[model samples]
Target chain A: MAENPTPTPARPRDAAIGTGLGRVLLLVYGIFALSASARALVQISSHFSEAPLAYLLSGFAGLVYIAATVGLAIGGERGRILALVSCSIELLGVLVVGTLSIADAVAFPDDTVWSHYGSGYGYVPLVLPFIGLWWLWRNRPRP
Target chain B: MNGPLSLATIVVALVLGVWYVIRCALNKAPSNTDLWSMLGLGLLVVVLVVVAIVGLFGPDRPADWTTFVGYLITTIAFAPVGVYLARLEPTRWGLLILAVAALTLPVLVLRLQQIAEVTSG
Candidate 1:
């Protein structure tokens, strides 16, 4: 197979953060960003009182996803910091929320993106953060 | 929202998704044929969405019509977005992106079907 040479100029090492596999990651992150935010919007608008805590968490998750997506899209030192922070928060949120949702069902009357390790969304939420972090780590500037 | 149409779309997407995954594993970029097949699947989704919109005006309409319409829009745009992103990255990962999009379509369709099933009118 002939090598598919990339025509884009190779400069600003940070550009690598949004190419190749990173682009695939961007697509997944974008999907999550849209779905999470939209879900939160619908939930909050239609029935905020039903599960305020869960709904708020849903909104927070949506913002985190949006931040991560933007960070990946931007792809530079600033973007890396943004992505790193959000991914860390996401990882913590999923683990904490997942465990709490299982241990104390009463508190979580309704589900958020992180609830039950995102079983409702096929656990993609649980796994996405790890992937995001790995991608960030892989793209980190070398000494 | 026709059962047969949804089933066909799901099957096609799953098949294409599998093929894309295999190609990615083999380190192959998305070929024109792959992209065209995805566009064809996108066309099928559009038909399905149009049928769903027509169904909304029929006797039985979804109780949460707004959410149903939202899913319809998302479902219809999914394939083209996948194709566009895949075009940007011409590598094995592009195939993976296509695979993800194809696989996600079935889930979206299933959700649409679920919403359609719960009728208020």
Candidate 2:
């Protein structure tokens, strides 16, 4: 943490994934990772028969969030690609699940993280992927 | 639960959340006071969780005890985790880290209250 009187050189694009607002995204993703996984664990363990599909989806959502968090934390070319895929999946999952949960409530007897566009957890689930993708795109390497 | 301690923690967190976000928006790094305030919040959370634990042994224990405990762990860890990340970044984003953590603490407390309300009949 020594202060360098001279200006530091510009950092490479590899470190872009975790700079500026990307750090905020990382914290949010980490929160979702914990919440989604913990919720899935409770649902699957406590009453698996009640809503197996929903519980499994919750587990999947948790994994996606975990990947996104890791990808953002480890900023580099690999991390960018990892985050891109995870964000894309997150976006699709929320949209598909959100629409289906609304259209066919019977099928979604229980709620996953994406159910009803994440109404239970606020609309963050729906909005998070877009921000994540934008961050990834903004940080994409320019050759 | 809806205890005074929980209410206090939520209020303090929200107030600090607003302050931190504003600081970040103004492009200020998390200063020493800002970081210390976060640590103070963490200490308050510790007290709140400890009280909740004591309440768990009361006559009207929550039916979903496991979930309640899970939330307690999350709530307690929230602030310190933010502080750790904030220290690492040493920039405006560090303040945002505090802002996000502070914002999330209230939600965690509210969730804890909901879970605690479902007592065994």
Mind listing the fnat for each candidate? Answer: 0.67, 0.56
Candidate 2 at residue B16, lDDT? 100
Computed on alpha carbons, the lDDT of every model, listed in order, comes to 0.91, 0.88
lDDT of 1 at B56: 93
Best by DockQ: 2
DockQ-based class of model 2: medium
- Model 1: how far is B35 from its true place, Å? 0.9
Report the C-alpha lDDT of model 1 over B63-99, residue by residue, as the tens digit. Answer: 9888899999999999999999888778999899999
DockQ of 2: 0.67
In model 2, the Cα lDDT at residue A53 comes to 90
Task: For residue A11, give model 2's deviation from the true position in Å.
Answer: 9.2
Write out the backbone clash pairs for model 2.
Answer: none
